[model samples]
Target: MNKHSITLSFEINEPQLLLRDAIKHYGISKKALTSIKYEGGTILVNGEEKTVRHILTVGDKVTIIFPEEKSSEGLIAEKGDFPILFEDEHILIFSKEAGLSTIPSREHPHGTVANFVAGYFAESGLSSTVHIVTRLDKDTSGVICVAKHRHAHHLLSEMQKAGTISREYEAIVHGFIQQDSFVIDAPIGRKDGSIIERLISQEGKYAKTSVQVLNRFHLQGEELTHVRLQLHTGRTHQIRVHMMSIGHPLIGDDLYGGSQKFISRQALHARELNLKHPFSGETLKIISPFPKDMKDIIPTKTTK
Candidate 1:
């Protein structure tokens, strides 16, 4: 097997179960099974090739070999130095910095996390393509998740839809928030005539963000509040829009009525992520420390 291919084996415990049912029970999608059948892959029972319809008795061993994957075209491999929080055969977690795009775009075609990951994969001789499961905004620094294969990507996507993936962010906003904790339940939609901006509207999709005030301090004669935010729904600019709607825009977030008095980018960092490992079914909690720009503004006496 190549570096990009995966082989999984299981001991059948139930009697007279179809191989197809067993595979499905193990979380292999029908599309993936179809690919294994048509593509260069194999399924074996007791060390012999077998069809999906074959009956499996207790003590039988089932093995599946997945086809090798290919990297996407036009995804150039570029070496870069970034912090890798955790990595395994199934997934890679990165502590990305600000001012770097997560993936290539029309405006930014290089120096992205995806390009760096592609370079790493090439150096490791793995043909798997870049599959980013969780992406952060260009100006937001935080923890990002990348899947190493298509099966892991599919499972992570499903986990996201089921609300099993959770993220927490720490942000410094423009004003002193009086509330200790609150939830901003609003609808977010694309702003009219602008593809990059989002606004809270009645006709928009449901979005909820819970906010907790961490500290209130004075910086250069301006009142600022450090807050921790938890996202209950994934929406474009949801945290920015929700914070702005509550009269406290993020510091340096000029697009959302904030001023860049002390910081260069939005003073937001993805602080924590909680999720289950797709392959091992174990809970994984990853964290990213505050970047230098944001950390410098906080008082030395205050704790994060």
Candidate 2:
């Protein structure tokens, strides 16, 4: 077995949030809480192991070890040189390109954003305690935040659980977005018997996305629509499943059978992020444009 070690001392008002966010920096595929219990590592809080439900005080020390597992790709580590969108004392945001998983997966162990980010940290001598504020699908590209320190990680994460951060995405779906603006308010959950699947449900977790039609046009015998999606509640693939439920899956997202006509990859991009700066207590908004393919599909003629 291989072993890796990390140590952090922080004034934490919350421990569970801190641990959960800390694990994200490792890019573990499982949920953070699950990672803590199952990652085969000893986690000591101020030199003592504690449960996730434990209440923590300030001045607690955290020590963790990342379990050694074979890389899925079985390839030599590659830097990948993923681009950065914004950075501050508390957070670092990346413009995660499409076709890249946010973190490592079994089949795609390498070439993930997390792996690249991890390599970057090792080279730059930065803290390894990256905290993911939110998650996007592998095919979805956009702004992703990583906390630089454990304290800020906990604070920013608590703010997220309290619904302080706002995120938006840009997508080009398969059909005309006839409505000027509409809402996809629904619940989402896992599909039975599938480890990598999602569906809409009545008893599932609640989620909402406000979709605004930027333009609509016809291209090569199929309806193409440009849209902006605002997430009110984050759920696993909520937007993708919701859009497919409405009969207009994204152009390339066959996972939801989005569009068989033109798009082959899920046509989604994390375009904007709004949140209060953890250290400054000031609101920060970051915006990014859609990829070249999406931008080219825009209806310059302007048909709503």
Candidate 3:
């Protein structure tokens, strides 16, 4: 057996049904079934090879061996330092530092989190491709989720679509917000003629962000507020755009009209993530502490 191949065995408990039906009842997807049939996978009943049409009965043992996975070309493995928050056979969660891209792009074709993960998989002898469940911006630091296999990826994607996965972020905005808590309901669309900029527009898709003031302080005579934000929609630059729309752009977010006199990049961090396990159905809460640069901005008791 390949070390990376996932094998699941189940003892049938229901009445007579086709093996395919049993597999579907167990949450196996149609695409996975097709892969099992066409790819180098195997299905067995009572320790003997069987097809999907085989009749399944109570007390029958069904075993499924998933196909081997291969990393895509150009995803060169490169080792780097990354903090692991949680890991299991089905999932891997890690804290990503600011200034590192989550995945490679044409401009940045290497040295990303994906490349490092590929290297980790190779060193660990896991024959799996990189499947990022939650992606953060290149300049955003926070916890990110990754699936270990195609099946896990599919299940987690479903969870994301169903709105079962949630995230919380902390940021320092330019101006102090008077309101303690509020929601920004706006539409976000790409700025005209810019592939990287997003703005509030009437023709854009709906985006909502819940904001709460965590603390208020003055830095070098400039008013600033620390806020917690939760996204109801995952639009590109949603938080940055929404904060700017409310007249409190994140500090150092120059693209969104924030000043960069104090910090080099946006003062945003993915603080927490809440989701149910794809396989175990248990709630998982992962947290990342404030990075040194973000923490330094907060004033001490005497300064506040």
Candidate 4:
């Protein structure tokens, strides 16, 4: 009957403590909080579902849509493109480019892979069930897996949860790393008046990434290392955060470290993946070569 609702924004230097204070002040459940994660929700700093506990940093914006008395829900959408990598009776893997979201979120409503893929399926006269098992950030590129049916979706998702799926990434960081390989084992959570950007937290989720030096190149005489990263545990911004922690932040990761970029999106790609077939029990391994943008950064083997 009334359209009046509370819309308040708070800027906090210590977001975690302030969020704790806000919850107490407003007496709202943690779930009612939009996009705030506790090393927490799967939503990201840019407003995607990120699974990490986040403590607020200086000048973080916390917006509260306030409590709901009662509510109804609907799935409304707009459309875009869906690049098909491989598809079969039940499984579909796609080459999702930078600027395409793997699924739906409050922040990226229009330019998402899900909406695009669903539309693509319709044009082809397919069922268009389009069940996404995992998601990539709006600016990250490469392979994403989805299911065409609910049964298939649940099975593959379960396998992913059980550690049966292997995902690998490629990134160009802003420095030359000496180690042939390194592992980043960090627990992450929320920070700032925001809910999505993750920071180290003992109360955070388990995230591990292993990186191997792929090559080194010069940009304006400054050398930057391109790396192949493997994920042991996937968390919000795992590669971006891990690389930043090691002083080799991604070339175009403005949130982590923004420098040394040639592309409009983050210079990260999900280059390879391995998984077990949800229904057939067959092992599936998929690899994607560097997209033209990422490939351009490296010199030919003869040149090096």
Candidate 5:
């Protein structure tokens, strides 16, 4: 078992309130309380261990020690130079690099973003669970959020399902886009006879994407359009397939008939994220600049 502990301390606000009620009032879950009772956790009042049934007065200092989570199976924490944009008690925002999968899969289980985060948590002596709130494609680079514990994870997941978590992306497509701004409203489903590829079909789930052209220029005699995209509904390869439907696939995306002359992977980056914090209720807007490979693929006027 891991030796580190997660401790939370606060003063009681109501007089004559029981320890369990105070904990619940402070947003601690009933399941966590059960863990404290059965999993060697501790509860203290004014530096002395107390039961949840004990009563409390105003300004009484109460502390709860949460034990370490047992190490999960098949997760080998490996350290790396992770780019952290923001971190707090509840969550973390990381700028994920290209070529790294967000989580482990059957074929490639190690060197994933989750493994890197586990390593960071271990090195920091933290015992909290690794909870990824947002996942990006393996070749996609940009900001992703990770919850430090289960409560935060639950809140964020609820927000995502409610369509409150907003994400923006940037990409360089193969052809110039004529419209300044437009939306793609279509349904997406697994391509027939293919397990991975997705297509636009009537018998698919609803998907919407908003696109705005940022820059239109020529690179090496090939017309390229730099565009900003907002996803109304998350779908596998939504942007890529939508753009392909309009005859402008992402640069270097071989699956959608894009050229690989400029870059080896898809020219897509999750550039921005906006959401409300689970605990603080404060708005968070995180942004990440384009990676070198993408920047080089869409050169500015000065370089051209």
Candidate 6:
């Protein structure tokens, strides 16, 4: 039993069920179950050790003790500034600002959301790896999630693959989209010569996006449309690519042929995230309002 082991307790409500059945009902992943079986983890009934095959009856108190993570390595915990939206022992959510990359890359070796989180964890005296569940592009400000440990990351990744994690983005595009709503079903692949740009192609991975226009405006003699988009598949630059394919690239998204006059970065913000808690099975909905730089694009009473 490590010092940071997680304990999950469940009260049996059914008449007769196996411990495994209860665990399944609780939405624990099979990979986690295997880890519990072999990684010094334990299952108990009331106070005694029990196996998954143990018969559970009404009011039986079942407990699972998960192994603790090993200490994180090779990370430089330099201090950074960001707002934490939600945090617990196993997870952290932050409102990352535009111009900040989610993780360190060759070009951005420091000053990323990961580095900021590393600094935060160091300040809090916690030893854990940076386990990001959702990633936002540099210049795309919004709500981002990170797991404090590897187990929570694994569970959240499973949820994402199952389409249980939902993300909504608000974007201001170049044109006034005539359709109130539409869906973009396209395959995306890296451009033939460019390493960073993604484009629609026949040989690419399948992707889908749903869009609904929120408001239309004529600002500074240019037409701009505020829209809400939902991603069915998480691909690199899915929204920008899809919108560009439809001749309405996001304002300030230079890579996608958008004009850079409105803002220095993409006129896109991750508006909301809906998902189940990795451990508690509770539904969590996190939101970030539209960034101030984008609000001027919206029509006011005078513009209307």
Q: Pick the candidate with the highest lDDT.
A: 1
lDDT of each: 0.91, 0.71, 0.90, 0.68, 0.85, 0.87
Candidate 6 local lDDT, 196-218, one digit each (tens) = 99999999999999999988888
TM-score of each: 0.96, 0.73, 0.94, 0.70, 0.81, 0.88
User: Where is the poorest 10-residue window by lDDT in model 5?
Assistant: 295-304
How accurate locally is residue 125 in candidate 6, as Cα lDDT from 0 to 100?
75
Model 5 spans > 4 angstroms off: 1-67, 302-304
TM-score of 5: 0.81
Query: Candidates sorted by TM-score, descending order?
Result: 1, 3, 6, 5, 2, 4
Query: Which ranges in model 6 have alpha carbons more than 4 Å from their true place?
Result: 1-3, 12-40, 50-60, 302-304
The candidate, 5 or 6, that scores higher on TM-score is: 6
- For model 3, the superposed segments whose C-alpha errors exceed 4 Å read 302-304
Deviation from native of the Cα of residue 122 in model 1, angstroms: 0.6
Candidate 5, residue 66: lDDT: 73
Which tens-of-lDDT digit does each residue in 97-177 have in candidate 2?
778877776777778777776667656655354356777788888888887654556667777778888898988887786
Estimate, for each residue in 1-304, the C-alpha lDDT of model 5 and write its tens digit: 2356667788988899999888887667777788778987889999999998999999999988876565545787889777788898778898999899989989888999989998898887776668898888888889999988765776688788899999999999987788989999999989989987898899999999999999898888988999999988889889989999889999988998898899888899999999988667799899987799988866657221
The count of backbone overlaps in candidate 1 is 0
Candidate 5, number of clashes:
0
lDDT of 6 at 247: 99
Global lDDT for candidate 1? 0.91
Winner on lDDT between 5 and 6 is 6
- Residue pairs clashing in model 6 are none
